[model samples]
Target: MAEAGEGRYEIASVISRSFETVRSNLGLFAGLALILSGVPAFALNLWQTSFGVNLNAAQPDFSALLSAAYLGPLFVGWLVAMVTNAVLQASLTRATVTHLSGEKPVFAQCLTVGVSMILPMIGIGILLALGVGLAMLLLIVPGIILWLCWSVVVPVYVQEKVGVIEAFGRSMALTEGSRWRIFLTMLLVLVGLWLLSIPVGLLTVAVAATGSVIAVSLVTAIVSALGSMVMVTVQSCVYVELRNVKEGVAPADLEAIFA
Candidate 1:
C-alpha cells in the first residue's frame, strides 16, 4: 500500500509538470480539434440516409447503418486526434521556448508538424485500438497497461522528433517508471470527460425533442471535441515535462527546432 501510494505521488508530480507545458499553449488545440471533428461531423451529415439517423429512434435500421458507418471519417477521428497532439506538442514546444527564451514561433511552423505526422498518427490509432482490444480480451488490466504506454507516443514523436517505432519506444520507456500512475491519470481524464458530458448530452436531447437532432449532435460533437482538445493538451504538456526531466533539454532548444 505504501509503495502504491508513493507511486501515485510520483505520477501526479510528473503530470503536474506536464500540465505546466500544456497551459502555455492551450490555444493551438482549438482549431485542430474543431477541424478534425468538423470534417467527420460533416461527412456523417453528407451520408444521412444510412448513418445519420439516431439508433434509439423507433424505426432505426441499426445493423446496416452500423456496418456502413464503421469505415467513415468518424473512425478517422482518432487519427485526427493523434495528429492534433503532434500539432499541439509542436505548439507547446514553441510556446515553451518563447516563455523560457523570448523566441516566438509562427503558425505555419505549427501546421507543418501536424501535417507531417499523418501516418504515425493513424498508426497510433490502430495500435491504441489493438491495445485496448487485447486488454479487454485479457481481463482489462493488460489493455490499460498498453494504453498508458502508448498514450504519450505522440509527444515523443513531436518533442523527440522520432519515427513511429521510436516514439513508441520513448513512450514505453517513460511508462517504465510508473505504469499505474499513468493509468490512474488517464482513467481520471476519461471518466471526468464522460461525467461532464452527461449534462451537455442531456441538454442536446432536450433540444432535439423540439427539432433538429443533427444540430443537437453537432453541439454534442463540439463538446466532445473540446474534451478531446483538453485531453491532448494535458497529454502534450505532460510529454514536455517528461522529456525535459528525461533528456535535460531545455524547452527553448526544442522550440528552436520544432517551432
Candidate 2:
C-alpha cells in the first residue's frame, strides 16, 4: 500500500512537470494526420464527380446518391479514427508524461489506451449514427445536439477505461468543468485545419483522373490521419489532467503509473 501510494505521487508529479512536451509532440503527429485525412474523402468525392461526368454528360445530378455513397464510408472511417484516436492520444499523453519524467512507454501503449475506449466509442458511433439517421427523418438540430453532447465520449472511455455506460457518465462529468474550453478549442482548430486543407481539397476533382489526384490523395490522407491523431493526443493530455483532478494523486503518483 505504501509503495502504491508513493507510485501515484510519482505519477502525479511527473504529469505536473511534463505539460509542455505533451503539447509539442501531439501537435507534430496530429498535423501530419490531418493532412492525410483529406485523401480517401477526396478520392471518393472525385470518383463521384467522375461518375457524374460519365452518367449523362448534362451536368447530371447525383448529389443525393453521392452523399449516401461517399459519406457513409467516410463516417465509418471517421468513427474508427475517433475510437482509435482516444487510445492513441491517451498513449501519446502518457508517453510524453513518462518521457518528461525520464521513463519509457511503448509506442503500443497508445493502442491499449485506444482499445479500452472501444465500447464507449462504439456507443458514441451508434448514437451519432442514430442521430444522423433521425436527422434524415427530422431536421438536423437534434442530431447536432446529441453529437455535441457526446463529443467527449472517446476521451471518457480512454482516460477512465470505462465501458460505454460509464463512459457516457464520465464524458458528461469531465466535460462539465472543461467542455466549453475544449469545444471552443476544437472549433478553432477545425476551422484552421479546414483553411489549411482548402488548397488540397480543391485539387481533388481538378486533378481527378490524373496520377496527381492519387498522389495528392495519399498525401492528404496521411496528413489528415496525423492531424486526427494529434488532436486526440492533445485531448488525451487534457483528459489525464482531468483524471488526476478526480483521482487526487500527488506529483509522484503519476510517475509511478507511467513507470
| Candidate of highest TM-score | 1
Best by lDDT: 1
Q: Which stretches of candidate 1 lie over 4 Å from their true place?
A: 1-27, 45-54, 57-59, 62-106, 245-253, 256-259
Q: Write model 1 residue lDDT over 139-220, tens digit each, in one string.
A: 8777777777777786777666778788888898765665665667667777877898889878877877878756665776
lDDT of 2 by residue, 1-259 (tens): 1223221223333233433554545553444334334444455544544443345556655675467666686677666555554444445555544544455545555446545555555566676577567875676766554554555565555434557777666766654544545455556656766887787677754554575645655655665565565455445445555456545643245566533
Clashes of each: 3, 40
Flag clash pairs in model 1: 18-237, 18-238, 135-143
